[model samples]
Target: MDCRVVVEAAVPVYDVSTADEAVRIAISKTGEMLNPDLNYVEISMGSRDCPHCDDELEPAFIAADEGLVALELEMTVFNVERDEHAARIARKEIGKRLKNIPLEVLEIEVLEEEDEEEAEAADEPTETEPDGGSGDEDDVLPEFEELIDE
Candidate 1:
């Protein structure tokens, strides 16, 4: 099963005023920190979905908050278990690459192709009932009344 993960991170910049500047600095730092051997992983600020049409849109940086820039990283792993681990590895590498800048991982969302059952489950609302047994009956609770007293 193939799994995909989208990691959203907020990196703080002290003197950056514009989103473009912040993105430029982030990309540069990422490039410096990336290992040549792990070039198979794809990292970008943009997504594969098209904004205007059904085509791919150009990558651009967006400011999440004042003095902070948001980054979106898309990566593929072999299994669902490896999604979070891969994101952590990428975060660690980026942090090591930038010593002065402080990077904070905001969220890691795992995206996998879901089957019909999974989709239906996700769409449906589940009703949970509270425990039916009242606490008044102590004898039928499985433990001895004296043991519970102790």
Candidate 2:
């Protein structure tokens, strides 16, 4: 499936007195956290209003708080399958790399998925057939009637 993982995190900056400084530190720290092996990775500092919102979400940073600002941030994992497992793996790697930084991951969201089959699966109801015959209740044996009663 065509999909991308977006990781949201809050990083606390120390010894910084200006918003720009906080951003610089955040970016640098995030760059260190990225995996060089990944095909594509993008990191950005989020605004106080909406942290973790990437380019797709169009995040807006209105005010830059100084002095130990916990900047909101996002790391997008590209060229990966659009699934929970991939997202978790990416999250773990990010957490491992950012162990030195006072970072707290907020959430991992699916930023984009370009898979038609996955979209259809979400909208379609699943169907299954009994071993003996069609899904009709009579097809189930008396001993297994209770199992499929629901």
Candidate 3:
């Protein structure tokens, strides 16, 4: 089974002003930490809502030239036995890159293998011939093969 996992991370950024700058710096810093190793992971700004009013809030909070930015990291885990397994794998993999950053598993979505297979099947072209031929003549030859034959 495959699962899509979203993990929330609290990344700390220093010497920053404004929530936007904090979030941008945090994203760039996180990407640098994960690159050349776990480059497949997708990083985005985390969403936060006020608990009392449910009003949308900024992903970063700045205080005294320091900021704690909320970021969401998404990655897909393949061939896992269960959703929990997938989440664990994702956390472990991401944690290794972002050391000392707090991580929480926000969401785990199981990907349906059947759906992927069905979509792939739908994309394949049918090999039907209107003139009752075997359709062998319609087969495309590889460019290298054609060159070699010529």
Candidate 4:
């Protein structure tokens, strides 16, 4: 059972513009150089995206001209755990490695949209449900066995 990690991070910045600059800073000396595996940075006038990460943390980094700019970055690592618990453990360890980030400087949000997506997809009607049948069990759902017998 292979597991994957999705990391989203954004930091308030100033005097920065363009994705290339952000990328340079991200992979540069003191900024995000620690996370060598860092995959991307998104730019929105001042923000950026890796174009390589999983969820496309376009929302991660942001920026401004004068007041304060923000930079967003996203990344994904594969085959790190054996299951959900192991994944969580790996995440905790990774979180510690990222503790140097200042909350006031950067904001990181790692949402579990995969589960949400799965729930949304599961809500869609399956083939067993007739086109117009209600959700009730007694609502005359189609049965493969009945069709075969017929």
Residue pairs with backbone atoms closer than 3 Å in model 1 (clashes): none
| Model 4, span 4-111: residue lDDT tens | 333333334445565445444543422454354432322222244466774443322434731222333333334443445434544454445456543121332344
Winning candidate number (TM-score) = 3
Residue-by-residue lDDT tens digits, candidate 1, 14-105: 55667677677666555555557445545566333466788864344344543454556554555545656756665565556555554444
| Full candidate order by lDDT, most accurate first | 3, 2, 1, 4
Decide which is better by lDDT, 1 or 2. Answer: 2
List, residue by residue over 9-32, the lDDT tens digit for candidate 3. 999999998999999999999999
Looking at model 2, the pairs that clash are none
Off by over 4 Å in 2: 35-39, 50-82, 100-150
Model 2: per-residue Cα lDDT over 38-107, one tens digit each? 4255676554443465333223232444344344444465555546666666667666776754444455
TM-score of each model, paired residue for residue: 0.40, 0.47, 0.81, 0.33
- Lowest summed lDDT across 10 adjacent residues in model 1 is found at 127-136
Question: Of 3 and 4, which scores higher on lDDT?
Answer: 3
In order, candidate lDDTs are 0.55, 0.56, 0.92, 0.43
Q: Relative to the unseen true structure, what is the Cα RMSD of model 3? A: 4.7
Model 3: ten consecutive residues of lowest lDDT = 129-138
Question: What ranges in model 3 sit over 4 Å off?
Answer: 119-150
List where candidate 1 sits over 4 angstroms from the true fold: 46-66, 79-150
